[model samples]
Target: MDANREIQAPNSGCKHGGWVTLPFITGAVVGLTLAGVGWTANLIVYLIGEFNLNSIDAAQVFNVVNGGSFVFPIVGAIIADSFLGCFSVISIFSCISLLGTVCVALTATLSSLRPTACNGGSGSSCNHDHPSSVQFLVLYGGITLASLGQGGTRFTLATMGANQFEKPQQQGVFFNWYFITQYAAYVVGATALVYIQDNLSWGLGFGICVAANFLGLVSFLSGNRFYLHDKPRGSPFMDIGRVIVAAFRKRNFPLSSMPDDYYNPITQAAPPKKAFRFLNRAALKVEGDIRSDGSIAKPWRLCTLQQVEDLKTLFRIFPLWSSSIFLGTTIAMQASLTVLQALNMDRRLGRHFKIPAGSILVIQILTSAIFLTLVDRFFSPAWQKVTKKSPSPLQRIGIGHGLNLLGMAVSALVESERLKTVHDQPEPTPIAPMSALWLVPQLSLVGIGESFHYPGQVALYYEEFPASLRSTSTATISLIIGIAFYLSTAIIDLLRRVTRWLPDSINNGRLDNVYWVLTVVAVLNFGYYLACAKHYKYQNVEKEAAYDTCD
Candidate 1:
């Protein structure tokens, strides 16, 4: 029974406590870089074009720019795993981003060299339509380069940060802190960049971004000694192909076909030479000497190809985290549409003073900072005790999806109110202006949802995937986000066509209709999320073995 219960234990030994701090520093760098490429560049572009581009134009153009990060994660993940490793990949990308930032800032500052229309280029704001073809190429090219660096580092940083705390017991706590800090980075980026763009010159704002990326490079390089520096797996193309083949075989295999006797969990007498044999107390019939927990008390074998294949099979059948895609879309709108919407909002603080519309972004950051304290110092530990069974990372993710629905619902209400006011009034006037305060509920709901979704997804992705496939698994999550961006685009278009009753007068390039559409999507996504939760179950393999033996 002891032999049956004891299989291979996971590689959980690590005495490191401060390894996570390094990533936090690196995360700040990422935050700054994101501000530069994502926020500062946006302001610069708008200023250069010096035109009143509306919400739709801003969302669409930004989507085109943001697409690079989504597309690059797969590349970054593959490279990080196969050759560069996380640290090197992160450093190199930071440096590249710094260069991209410099290029854009210089272009903005050197506007006298080209025609005014081309000053910023053909877009809303640019300096000198690229001075020449070469300048234009260089400017746009710089943006793409920055995207590569940001995307590469963004995908790897969180995973690498989590890697610092390796033990299972510590992993949960470590991840909690890990997620808190990461979300905090977004908060910092959004708030800080918005302030810079609103108050400071665009050149200064972008220069700050460049400096942040440069500092990120320095900080990441400084931490070389403490980091684990694990070798990244190469591209998963071969693995993906193998997975497809195996899936096809499973479909073609006879219905009567049973698992191979040698691989069968029910009849296996001992662990395969390299496979660990763990006793499962959950088994009704104890095939061997069972310990108190009905588990083998010692390690039996190492991992084997067969066991690896079996694990692969387990991964293949795992239910799709379909609802997560919606959560991603919700958070993503902060980057894409939310900024556009804010731009259209009345930024009047009171009489003579008006806040920058972008300044509202601070609300998200402050909210995250507040929530992180509450969750880590209060909610997480307390919830752990109350549940008796520790909350599965995926469950946290599910709750996050629910929150996303609530967030979008709030956003829909605010937009609906704005629409009503605009329709009833002669113009968008201060006397009957839709209160900017309404955006508070929307932002707050998003913050709460983010508190759950981002952290939960990070932990769930890493904990669920086998080590050999970590890079691909992490990258896939980013790819899914990218897909969601395109999906949002499609959703917006569909809403516009479906609501012909809305009249072009209302939608007239405003995102009011689209915001409501997102709300419906969020509600539907929430229902789908519940279904997904019902369909899935988490497998803490180590704990399962322990429980099997004790039972």
Candidate 2:
């Protein structure tokens, strides 16, 4: 809490926004992140341990669930932007998440939902018991509902929280805290909750998640009076589609330089930019374009100048957006493979204290949470003080690109060391003697990188995108992540088929080569990002130094 912050009244008015709403919004963020990561962090373990799934089947199910969770945010965002406002959408989805968690908890509690437990002795594989159709239904149905709930609320809350502040700088500051809070909650979920789920009881673990989800819903609604809501102005996607159709229909029309030659809602409205000049024709007014009331006679053939420019903005951003795909893919792959690495190494902390393979990833989340605070408190100020300006969003993203690529390089080196240790070990020694803590540096580097790029990407997309797509803008990251999940699977499969880099026994395979390959790809992607960013122009005054102003 800021010392001088004023408490706003409970009246829901247009002036109700700014720091007054921070508590409620942040509370909701904590709840959602905690709840979402709880089940997700240990999903594969739950499937294999309880449902008697094979490693391959469990991994496949995890991918589907994870991918759905990331991809469904677009659906939530579209509904929020087009019909229900962010508040309604988030509230609705949070309940859906709670419901999903409840269903999962039921599965954990009820005996009928699970298959027979494995009874195989040491050094022998148990014949996996196949679950019945009804069991599968309950499990998958709950997963679907939960994914929908978590996905819809995740980034939509981000957009809503940012909307509380009018200043672009304040929004950026909110984003920083938003991610910090999220990463912190991720640590709790991945470590504490996962331990509870694995050691204590799955029912209790999921029940706690359900409670968290419900708490998030209540916390969000607590600020309803303080929220400055964006009224749904109909489907933004339709507007985007209309712009494309209109532009193509008028593609052959010559763009007129005169301002009056276009259709602007305001009488003296400025003309759209000439960047995508061909798109400007969508706003060009022909004799039959506008009716007596100034509405378009042909909805598909005519669009607002704003709509035309909005489409152009997406077109301009596409290249920079594409560069992030590989980054996301690398992140997904590393997250999955690191757990495997941990499983193969000495994960003991002290006598009788073995680290869970699933929880090893929390190191990354913990590092990100810690450094995000540093970036917010010390680093940004120091940078501003030394350079006479704060780092821009693009500068932050570029730094992240380098740091993340370096992390990949480090992963390769560490894997090489681990492989050498594997070779040095006496015959039949399964687990490598190398401490799993060696994996921490690579993960931490990526975590630190995320502290820069993740928030930077959020702020960049939110500020640069048109007002109509604010919610969708945040979800674009989700969409990118969704795509990357599939790409990661595809890449790993390709490696398995064509090369020995990712054989069944990673200790026998050239695992370091996989990291090196990712590193090379990331470096090339970084170069592409640089090229795009070098030529990219910030859309307006707000986009110019918005991130720096956050400091």
Candidate 3:
């Protein structure tokens, strides 16, 4: 038997789900990511250029928007797994995204919706047209709705794609492919769409985003007849609550040694493992715990062995998940800082071409996209050949941690160089003479690190999670990113209030110190992750050796 065939494929006799579903899934992911990233990629630029916000203010708004986009997925995932299912959730949100992009486009087209354009210069001399409170409300409304749409579809789409495969190895490979498509879309959006928004018209660029969103929805809906719709098993959160309540109620019941003392499935009647023995009380089969028909009689007094085990699994995984939050926080901070760095640095490629400040992040996106294929194709196979076993998810995450630390160090060195050049000047210059290409090395390393850890975390969560909570499993990543981004905002705000590291004018601020701080944070977080990975145990017994995986 194939070891990686972990889950029994549901409703196998039905004709849906297989390689045939790949094209539609791929199309949906590509179109949605393309449109979603188009606007998102140039957001700081838009808020600064179109909305007349200063650099620090724009970064703050960007973090909040980014955080919300990621945070909403948990709710969307719960609703899907509980009632609507992935198809419905994706469909509804795609339209919402389309509506949002259209509204944002309106802000670009209708001059009345925006503040009057500022004369191009700094300070009171430029006489900037500050957005009225009413104008800010209209603009924020569009961005908020778009973020909600983004939050709804992003991780849920990954869950839906993974569901199309039967083997655990295949599911792992699908996640890799999905991210490649996603990053490719990001590259295009950052480069081409940003060029349009910066060079041509914001309205036209946003119009293109709306069109792409619509097309993505169309492709996703076109595949409905071919999809294997997984029915919801009700809210898993309610079951989680039940487990806690039942265990507390039976806190005083003395544990029994007999095989029949606990609830078990008919064929799988083996006794529960001894880990977290306190939770085992929930599954204890007391005299009145079961009804005459064998159903659970007291909802809050008794739970199945599986429910107890599921809660225990979460308890074990939470520490590792918590470690990842700071990792994300550092990365989010870097993303914002990189844009600010590029804005101040020399962005020229040659005599004829100049790089867009916002589009510079595409280097990071492209590196991730290119290396995903390489890591999936060559790296894992080589590791398996040398070690006589495939690399596990924790091992991959450890490598990512090391690379992230190195990237932060490089970023600090680069910023120190850029600042030295600025200080050498007798007076403050609008832009540094140092080429923006200096930023690429750090971005690429961070990108490579993402190629390793992001997919590893996804596969690890999905493989280790209880079957009843699969959709929510992937959504957990969104939750981490969401919290990290919001925390980053708070950190930045605090820095501004107390220190001079992130001044409104980044050129005057100690940008290098910020990178140094993130490096220290990454170092401490990496140590924490190593401790967690060292003690953690793998839950999934399924291990298919046939396919090459990102791990």
The global C-alpha lDDT for each of the candidates, from Candidate 1 onward, is 0.56, 0.82, 0.83
Candidate achieving higher TM-score, 1 or 3: 3
TM-score of 3: 0.90
Candidates 1 and 2: which is better by TM-score?
2
TM-scores of the candidates in the order shown:
0.73, 0.87, 0.90
Is candidate 2 or 3 superior in lDDT? 3
Q: Could you tell me the lDDT of residue 161 within candidate 3?
A: 82
From the highest lDDT down, the ranking of the candidates is 3, 2, 1
Clashes of each: 40, 0, 1
lDDT of 2 by residue, 1-551 (tens): 11112233346444488898889999998888888889888886787677876543455566677778899889988887678878889999999998998888889889888777544311113344678899999999999999999999888888788777767789779977887788788889999998898778988998899888888888989888888776666667898889888889999898888888888885677767878788898898987888998788999899888888889999998888888889888888888778767767998889967787778889888888788779989988998898777788888888889999999999999999999999997784558899999999999999999999887898788778887776577789999888887788788878878997765446778889999999999999999999988888888866565444322
Q: What TM-score would candidate 2 get against the native?
A: 0.87
Model 2 CA deviation exceeding 4 Å by range: 1-27, 52-57, 118-128, 162-177, 218-230, 252-254, 267-273, 503-505, 541-551
- Model 2 lDDT, residue 162, Cα: 76
Judged by whole-model lDDT over C-alpha atoms, candidate 2 comes out at 0.82
For model 3, what is the C-alpha lDDT against the true structure?
0.83
What's model 3's lDDT at 360?
A: 87
Measured over all alpha carbons after superposition, the RMSD of each candidate to the real structure, in angstroms, is 9.1, 4.7, 4.1
